[model samples]
Target: MTASLSWQKSTYSQEQGDCVELAVIGGAVLLRESDNPAVVLRTSRANLADFLQVIRQGPAKNSPPGR
Candidate 1:
């Protein structure tokens, strides 16, 4: 059987201008905007998990905040 791909909004999304959508396909991860679905960024599952871990770890005081 083949795995299907679907997109879902991020739970971290708030009323602010920030929003994101994620898709899982063939053991990989894909991310895109809630408004613009045409553009997508692809990454490995491990890489995506690591990226999320870093984001969850929060930013340093001297570091520029992510958008």
Candidate 2:
């Protein structure tokens, strides 16, 4: 969204509508919808790393989707 940061699409992003853009600014990571770039969200490195870890592991067999 800013003039300095370079945004790139997610590696896991396919040709489908599910896609996110990433940009690194200073010590923070910025994320936003590829379809709607105006709505941007920023997160700390630690939080982002944790989120990615969870996504990679995925949900347990007996657990719900959000678990």
Please report, in order, the local distance difference test score of every candidate based on alpha carbons: 0.78, 0.86
Which regions of candidate 1 are displaced past 4 Å? 1-4, 14-18, 61-67
TM-score of each: 0.68, 0.75
lDDT of 2 by residue, 1-67 (tens): 4656798888889978669989999899999887888889999999999999988997878996765
Model 2, position 9: C-alpha lDDT score:
86
lDDT of 1: 0.78
How good is model 1 by TM-score?
Answer: 0.68
Q: Residues 11-56, candidate 1, lDDT per residue (tens digit)? A: 8788666589888878778888877767789899999889889989
Task: Return the top candidate by TM-score.
Answer: 2
Give me the runs in candidate 2 sitting further than 4 Å from their true place: 14-18, 65-67
lDDT of 1 at 46: 94
Q: Distance from true position, residue 32, model 1, in Å?
A: 0.4
